[model samples]
Target: MRLKQGSLLWYLYLDKSYCLLSVRNVKALVEYFHLLDVHGKNTLNDVLFYHFLHHVTDLKKRQINLVFDMLDWSAVGEIGFEQFYVLVCILLAHQNHLEEQFMYRHSRTVFDLLDLKGDLRIGPKNFEMYRFLFNIQKQELKDLFRDFDITGDHRLNYQEFKLYTIVRINKLQKRQKKTEENAERERSLCSRKCRIK
Candidate 1:
């Protein structure tokens, strides 16, 4: 539940080639769309959508609604193949540990998703509802707002959001690097101990 920086926990839980989908991936997704279309409506209602989300992700249930909301743009209570495809892509990206990259690539979409009320911008209030989706803590989000809200109006425009994504990606990379370095040190120490024995 905590967003551990070194793992997928940092982002809304999901994977990566999955990120760079080949045509075959798209074809398989089309088949999946058909399989999930139990009502033959070529759309997924909240029920079907929730089921699909549960099928792919390991718990952390609430984040699903935010994602579902992102896809259910028309507020029609149903989503079509396109939206479903995007959701799957997001899942794949997260699963492959490519969330930072995915966010960077799809910043606008993410910004729109965060701007829950169709507002031109996003602020802490909007983020509070979807915070579980990113799993950020109160202090971290406060830091984010303090640093990124360039206009000091307590909201983020698309450009500001884009900058935030870049900064987030950098922080993730740094954390991953530090984790790798620590693992290498552990391995090196273990080898030395083994050789000494």
Candidate 2:
């Protein structure tokens, strides 16, 4: 996946090399990935991956299969630690509603998974359809395109999409915080007062 230094993909696979994280943490992650290589083939087959996904994420059977197929970019029945690690990042980011943040930073991997066509660019509709992979509904996608299509060409290349994801995620977080604040206010005794027309 190009493996550029300091990139998200690079961080996932080579943070140990760079010594960017704790040595113990890196060892733990490496050991976990190795342990999943139950047959010692240095690759994970469907069974191992299925159990991994089943425990960590809410993906249905069909969705899990689809994810496996995509990660099996070689069309082989097994995938190495690099592929497995990419899936791990995807699942964690998705569970936290951070798809855009992860995708924007790891555009190459994200584009490979979601480009749908080999066209090197994507429209908001693509986001709408495939965002379900992250278990996210169609929130503000079209509006994002309309608002952030800075080139005015109605499609997002990697850089533009990165900017879009950052903005969209920031807005989502803001909305979530606002919702939490409003809920807190609603539960407060002083909030018993209501306005009447």
Candidate 3:
């Protein structure tokens, strides 16, 4: 909900990779063309209207529009952010609570940016959601995490691992964003605070 330096960085990174497609010559691309509405919604049309279509070449417009339409929620119109978020959560849950965990991790990062504490952990009431997230295809989270080996060894130190992992993730993401933004700004500016005179 609240965007902080860290969250902004994460968004920018994801945006750059998924939306921007790592286009080195950003002048050729529109920024918004890459956001996926939280629920696999039609964010592309919004971009087309607000940013892309005007800037991109005519040939690119038709191709982009077709792709955008296909990504829409109902194929009738675009999906809203909240809906997109929910759909993504549900899919990430994949029949269990993996989606919840993913959101919890994200929420924690948000909290860190706000410098406030929030309870983003899963509780008994929501345990069923986790089960639903991964159990659909006979996937068990316990085994999955075991395989993930959070410690990078063979066992998980549950009490210490995830918290550390999430915090480091948030920090690394923020740093990456700062680095990228600096590079982007430098790339955009042709002169170094010097007058043409």
What does candidate 2 score in Cα RMSD to the true structure?
Answer: 8.9
lDDT of 3 at 77: 58
TM-score of 3: 0.24
Candidate 3 regions exceeding 4 Å error are: 1-87, 90-153, 184-197
lDDT of 3 by residue, 108-157 (tens): 32222222112333322223223332232234334434444545544334
Worst 10 residues of 3 by lDDT: 109-118
Model 2, 1-197: lDDT tens digits are: 11123423333432312213355545666677788788999898988988867665556787678778777877788888888767766654554455656755676777666665658677776666566655545556667677778888887777777776677668777987999998898877455664321
| Candidate 2 lDDT trough over 10 residues, lowest sum | 1-10
- Where model 2 places Cα greater than 4 Å from the true spot, the runs are 1-23, 123-129, 144-156, 170-197
**How many pairs collide in each candidate, listed in order?**
8, 0, 16
Q: What is the TM-score of each candidate against the true structure?
A: 0.75, 0.62, 0.24
Best by TM-score: 1
Give per-residue lDDT, candidate 1, residue 162. 94
Off by over 4 Å in 1: 1-18, 55-66, 185-197
